[model samples]
Target: MITTLRFTMLFAAALCAAGCGSDDEPAGSGTPGTGATTSSQASSGTGSGSSSGSGGSGSGGTGTGGDVTTTVVVNEISAKGSDWIELGNPGSAAADLGGFGLCDSDATGLCNTGDALRFPEGTELGPGEYLLVLGDQAVEVGPGPHTTCLAEGPSSCFYATWKVSASRGETVFLISPNDHVLNQLEYPMEAAADGQTWGRLPDLTGQGGVTAPTPGAANAAP
Candidate 1:
């Protein structure tokens, strides 16, 4: 009877010990939460979004890269013989001169405008090239196709609206069609006279001075 009772006690102790043995690994040993994101998962999601956007159904013609803005400046001016205004391209690229504008004085608009001129269509200027604009009629030169003077230029001809005042020098303005001023200067009264011309000394860089005529060509020392 005593041996049987001891054997039953030992069996009960073994059952308790086996049930209490820990089966858990650790606190952080489980899988990640459903809301958590890994770095690789984030990268993969971004790549998929980009790919889906590129696969959208949209079409268009080839792109021209939009309008290119190039540098074209006033190279020379002449209030004397033929009354020519010269433009120079000092840059290394070709520029479209279409829709460029000029004015003898500051032009507010068409009503109170001084002598203003506009370049004809299809006008172009190349690298290191020169352009000459002449005054023929004694009237104001409005925008394109409104001038009376014919273009005698190789590339294109632009005519001044009114004769440049040699006696009463006024402001000379070079503007784009969008009313953007490219170059402007105040021509002092009697800036050039007696067949002498007012122009840029070294073509594109030097200061303005009275020099010999170099219409449609490089400027030289007077």
Candidate 2:
């Protein structure tokens, strides 16, 4: 009986050791398999970041638009009896002449003067339309299909306070609202005859020549 009891106790001790060893396992022996999944997840995160960066770069390439430029021209000038300057808009769109300036100078290029005559607010020149700016002593030279005027008071005539010399050649400048010179022309003293006017031959885009005084109408043949 004593031998059998000792054998049973030895068997029970061996079973308990086997069960405890299997339950404990090695601390991190199974972690290597899980590490592969973590690495795959890290790779996925990196790809996501790269895609986000690409989208950000695409959003930064949309700031290269075009700029607006003026197309109006100084079509005609008269330094005679009724000192007037004619501005024509041959473009397709109307031009807002408000805040635009006009100055008489002897400079061959752009004229910069502090006493420029600025167009009144709400002044506009429609497409293919002509605007006549008259001087204080200017009067309608002839009669035609031209009767629109922009004046401060209740008058049907638009008059300018500035005057151009009839004997001396001078440069006339058309300035934009931002103080940029739009167009300029230097008239000769010979072209400033009492009853004549210097204008673009074909209206807006032609060579300058002296013609009959057409205050608000198309230039006539010399």
Candidate 3:
């Protein structure tokens, strides 16, 4: 009977030790928790979203291009008999000179008449091209009248019915189709010579000086 009691006690002690060991064990040792796995996946998704956002910002830095501007200028002038004014296109592309205006300025360098000679339709100056407008008296000389004036049969010259003042040395103005002034030149009475022509020295951007007549060509060296 005593032996039987001792065995029963021993069995009870073994059961207690097993229960204590199971209660003390760490949780989630055999399998992961559902909540913990979901949190880990959310963090990974957030990291991926941030990377994608950074990529989008990098691509947004590239933009569209710039603006382009163009201009034309008065290149040369001849106040002598059969006077002519030269228009130069020094830009990269052809310029439409249609509806452009030319006016003879009074002694005060102001256009009093509001009377401007407008270019005919379809008038275009090519890149680096020169256009010559000749006065009424000028048609008598220098390549002759526009009809048969060309040495090569066709000419690059146009007739201007108005004559430039040779003795007074008037101011010349170049006007756009919108009546905006593009360029102007004031010449003194002494600058007008009967045979010599006053023009820009080095083509488009030079000081005016007395040189030989160059009606349909570049200005001669001063």
Candidate 4:
């Protein structure tokens, strides 16, 4: 809130300064009103004219602005029993859900279409919290930082309906709120001699990566 207000104050000050400089002409000039006052002429008038106009304009506004420094982070992705994608908002301001989306890649291509879960008018994810979304539903619907266990049991299987079944070498993708791909997981469905089945790759942030298992056997968690 303070950040947005600060930006607004700065912007308003700028606009007022810009407007004041153009308001000191005569009644025929191209200044704000009908007046003709050149720089030399206005400079000669009482400095009070510029200062007064600036003060008036600056004090006339509401002094409010929208969110600033807002961002969304993909914290975790699970495609097992119930496909669930977890998002974290580590920003100072809340994010609007109006323009977010989720998409998948396949032969048919990006097949997600439904209502988008918009952060409610005052919905904010407070810093360091998670927004867990069930894949099958619209991207806009989810358990935000303030929600309990999806209103379902603690098994996490509530998301099972959204899981993407993997073949021996298939892949799964977790898209962003903008429908852009966030991360992908390519793993071996069948366990190897080491007993570890592939999981989501590590070290993925803004782009992409491969999902591989750590030093463990199949059924090991990522």
Candidate 5:
């Protein structure tokens, strides 16, 4: 009886050992190596997605650009001829000179207005190009802010006169149609009678030669 009992106990111990080994093999096969492979693939996919997203974000916003500028060079105030307002383009790119204006303190009709000048739409002034807007009868050149000059120039086209009765000198302010103060000149120490030009010549006296512009700045020398 004792021998039989010992034999049964040894068989039971062997069965338990076999069962443990069987359970361990599946745990090894289903887990460690497979789990690592899956994790690595998931990480690689996430990395690729992040990289593509960043690349797309970097390619989204970009434009073409150019510049336009105007300068007033007061050539000569006329005696019998029409008063002249000289316009010049000093920029690299061509600019539309439409919707521009010129004004003086004393204007009749549209002669004195801030919205006086009207160029053809898309009228581009190339670098160093110039145009002369005859300050005719519609434009009464005097002092102060005015808005009718350009609108009336066509009407005053018959007689655009800027006759200044100078007392020593006079001041003429050229306000742009854009409301930009383009040029201002104070003619001093001259005759106080009509006929003399209100501005300094660009070549000789430097008094009325527009604003002596800073290089690279608006109104700068070409």
Candidate 6:
């Protein structure tokens, strides 16, 4: 991910598989379709509700800082069906995701800094690859990325201090190595609570909106 932005709101009510994401321990045993919910609409550009432009893969994030160029972008946010954060690499080359960090604001307000999650060293995401981080603080981190649940079937999630709200709304921030905001999402509760998920089809640089949950894969409609 890259760039700095004032605001980018993605509806939390977007995509998610029949099993949004695995909330249970391993993979198949976990039950999905019952995580955080989402809202509606994804706005790009300057303001909060503007509806135009794809703005590249690295357009939205938190705070202001130096500019960095990385292909990994926050591709999908599944509030409904299940709760998980999906990141993707759109460039042709693999991205060295080491040291990247992200955080979520209180379901009611801005980020609490202390809840930030820093990627482990040597973390990586191949070109066009998708990584899913389930939203559940109960699971323990294992060998995968920086910190995440054990190498489960496919989706090995990392935990966070906060959970995206389907009723009140939530803001998730992606930070670059330099601590600059790589991409930020602040979707409303209406969007988070309605749609199955809010995601970008065609992968990274597409428009974000309500769609089916295709975690660890490309975004698509049901």
Give me the runs in candidate 4 sitting further than 4 Å from their true place: 1-70, 108-123, 137-162, 168-222
lDDT of 2 by residue, 44-127 (tens): 121111211111111111222211134556667888766778777776667766666766763333354465667766677677
Candidate 6: which stretches are off by over 4 Å? 1-65, 106-110, 139-155, 192-195
Which 10-residue window of candidate 2 scores lowest in summed lDDT? 38-47
Off by over 4 Å in 5: 1-76, 79-81, 106-115, 138-178, 186-206, 209-222
Tens-place lDDT per residue, model 3, 1-222, is 999999999999998887655566776556555443211001112111121111111111122211111245555667765567776665666766566666666445564335566677677777767777765534344332245332421275666555567676665555555554455555546684677776666665565667677665777864
Q: Cα deviation of 38 in candidate 3 (Å)?
A: 71
TM-scores of all models?
0.56, 0.57, 0.57, 0.36, 0.37, 0.62
Task: Name the regions of candidate 2 deviating beyond 4 angstroms.
Answer: 1-68, 106-112, 136-157
Name the better of 2 and 3 by lDDT: 2
Report the C-alpha lDDT of model 5 over 75-114, residue by residue, as the tens digit. 2332222344444443444544444444333323122343
TM-score leader: 6
Task: Give the range of the ten consecutive residues with the poorest summed lDDT in model 5.
Answer: 57-66
Q: Name the runs in model 3 displaced over 4 angstroms.
A: 1-70, 137-154
Candidate 4, residues 9-75, lDDT tens digits: the string is 9998988876565455565645565655422101112121221111111111112221111344443
* Native-structure RMSD, model 1: 19.7
User: What are the lDDT scores of the predictions, listed in order?
Assistant: 0.54, 0.57, 0.55, 0.35, 0.35, 0.58
| Quality of model 3 by C-alpha lDDT | 0.55
Residue 136 alpha-carbon offset, candidate 5, angstroms: 2.9
Q: Pick out the ten consecutive residues of candidate 4 with the lowest summed lDDT.
A: 52-61
lDDT per residue for candidate 6 within 1-222, as digits (tens), equals 223222222222234323365566575655777676432112223323323222234422222345454667777777765677778777777776666676666434444455667777767788878777766454355323434433431535565545677676666666665555555555556564444777765567665666676777787764
**Among all windows of ten consecutive residues in candidate 6, which has the lowest summed lDDT?**
38-47
CA RMSD, predictions in order: 19.7, 23.2, 25.7, 22.3, 23.8, 26.4
